[model samples]
Target: MSAHNFLGNLQTYTDGLVEEGKTPAVSVAVWKDGQLHLAASGILNVETGVEATTDSIFQIGSITKIMTVSIIMQLVDEGKIDIDMPVRTYLRDFAIADAEASETITVRQLINHTNGMSGDFFPDESRQSGNQIARYLDRINRLPLIHPVGEYYSYSNAAFAVAGRLIEVVTGVSWYNAIEERIYQPLGMSHAISHPMDVIRYRAAIGHFADQTHPEGWKQTEQLYLSMGQAAAGATLTMRAEDLITFGRAHLEGGITQTGERWLSKTSLAQMQVQQVNVPTVSKAFTKGYGLGWGLLHHKQPEDTVYGHGGVTYGQLSMLRVIPKQNICFAILINCSEMGMMTEITNRFLNELASLDYSEAQAKFVNLSSVEQKRFLGTYASLGDGFRIVSEEDHLVAYYEDTVLKTPVERYSLGALEDDFFYGFNRDGSVALELQFKDCQKDGRYSYLFSGGHLRKRVLE
Candidate 1:
């Protein structure tokens, strides 16, 4: 079916989420071949009942990691910094709990999340002053290494915080200003802003906390900000789903924007997406290996790859995906800590767009109606999180949105694979994860996924 056909079901589907109290507000978009498909539903605020739109800005959490990496890549393109250089080269006074690891961590390791440092320290809790990130780096000096640098995969928000500091050292500007100057402005993303106060100038989404006492209700979350201290770790920058896809397109197009703006060298863009570390345990399953801010995703088949990132913050959640081979991108943003809404919406949308094939090679390859293609079309869930595996005309894709814990929901894409039994591969094709589905007439369908060291089960209803 054409993408527009899915739009018909989108409204009804989105209404179900809001009516069910699973989300407060949301904005979603998919971009391909220079065209866009968009949708929205729910309210921006639970109390105000402020209507949401495709333009509604959301706190894009760690999705900002991609923007941070973009700036770093811009610097790489300009020869202002080298990815392999030691972190100490820029922050000479910086120290971590593990002195040796702190001394040896490379810039590349920090971006790919293998820096071996404690990453979640949220100092400057007040989210104050533009100078806070500098202080954050100072506070970071006291942290011990989580593992040997370059030896393991650990998602470190602080690593990105330090990355912001390094951006400051290289560019002579605050990280937010650098992102605005280097990434957003060049791409012509007018509705995107990195700081909290600035978001007030636009139609924005207010994240609402899901009620702990009542699973089906929501209460307003307190206003929050991304302190200049933690901006790189995606403390909370509001963005429209459409604007993010514009950024994704830039990445898919090799650091070049649709308007012909050159954001980074093609080589630098490629460098940022290259798998730099193993992240087999990431719950989102978008990628098995970590790249810069991006994760390399293997679709439902071997050799199929895509790259993307996810975002999360208090009362907010986001997911982004980019298929470079097809120049296709999808972004979903929502307000509310209840991530089940994201799971429901993203799964249906991806499946609806499964037949999208704009390229000639892709058109012939996707042939959606083939018997082989139907084998993978279904919703598979594990541990209350949802994963959708569908046959895109060209390849099989495993779509995921995880809300197992914490603020941000994890949204991911994995390559779907099947032979004698079903399985999945990471974006770089390094890890093989088993996927088992069983039919149960009484209990509905069930999925058993082995991830994060347990067999997580999600029901298909």
Candidate 2:
């Protein structure tokens, strides 16, 4: 199909999806075979009745992590930092609650999420004055390791915040300013902004929450951003979908900008895209493994190699995907927290444009005896949330509680896929969760539950 016809069809499909109330708004940018296509649909804000356009800016969430790691890699290229070296080598004062782990954690561990520190250490304050990334250390110092250092893959937002601080120390500039100077300007991404205040200069999209009580079945989110201090972990960065793919295009071209200017060495770019650690089997729906900052999709197939990142903050969710061998890049930004909608859109785009299918790969269900299920039944909890597994008639059910968000509890039915691995189905029978039990105790009960990128310990009564 011609690029013109493809874009027109995409625009129509996006419009129909939004009109069906899947989400409030969405903007997409696709670059394939040296051609760029852009499409957008729905209102930026229902309250304001502003229509979304290709230029509309939406929070890119954790996709900001790629920008953060790009800067870190630049430092690597300049010989100012080493990925394998201990993080404390550069940040002398760096210390977490586990002093031993803090001293031994490497720069590579932080970027790949093997540092094992608690992932969701958001400070109470918002937009604090003076080096917010640096000030994050005072709070992170108290966090205990959720897993042994470099032994497990537990996503850590705090680790990346520490990395952001390392950038400030090495460059003598705020993390925000460093990215703007090194990434945004050089890549010609004029539509990007790291601060919320600057969002006024563009047609910015406000996040939306699904509210059945509202007449429109959705309402604008009360909070627009997550904690500002964790900007390195994808808190406050907003940009147009076009600008996002621009950055991805640079990486797709092996770290060279459109004008043939080298932003990072080919070596560093390759390092960032290579698999650093394997993720849980459930995570393979989106990525099989993780690279330095990029999530490795189709890592085993070199000819079809693709790497990208997804971001979430407040009510917004965003995704960026790149197929290096095809010289293709695409970005999707939405103002509502709708994972299913995003997944469908991603699968459709990839199937049509790249001849690739991205459907979730589900494991076959294996029935477990009551004796087998008994060992896994219990409450497993993290700092802010937990899951209580109870045996139902034929399968196990997990009651999920969100302590931090104070949202209503959700329930999922668990079907054993193996001795310790299980896939969870929502009430609607959708396969939305995958979890594993690890670290069995002498008493025959498991000691930890790995789900949702967190390792939650078994809570005793």
Give the candidate number with the greatest lDDT: 2
Measured by TM-score, how close is model 1 to the native structure? 0.74
Best by TM-score: 2
Which parts of model 1 have CA positions greater than 4 angstroms off?
1-4, 127-130, 212-216, 226-228, 281-287, 355-461
> Which runs of model 2 end up more than 4 angstroms from their true locations?
1-5, 283-287, 360-363
lDDT of candidates 1 onward, in order? 0.69, 0.85
Model 1 lDDT per residue over 1-461, tens place: 56666655666656777776667777788885577878889889767778998888888888899988988888888888888989888889778768788788899988887776755566545735447878888786667554467765667778888999999998998887888888788898889987776888998887778775643377777646545577888985778998898888888887777788677888888788888766553233233666788977665553346677777676788999776766678998888765445655655555566542211121111133446544445664432255666665556666666442334433333443322134455555533354444322353333333343223334344
> What are the per-residue Cα lDDT tens digits for candidate 2 across 320-351?
99988877889999999888778788777777
TM-score of each: 0.74, 0.95
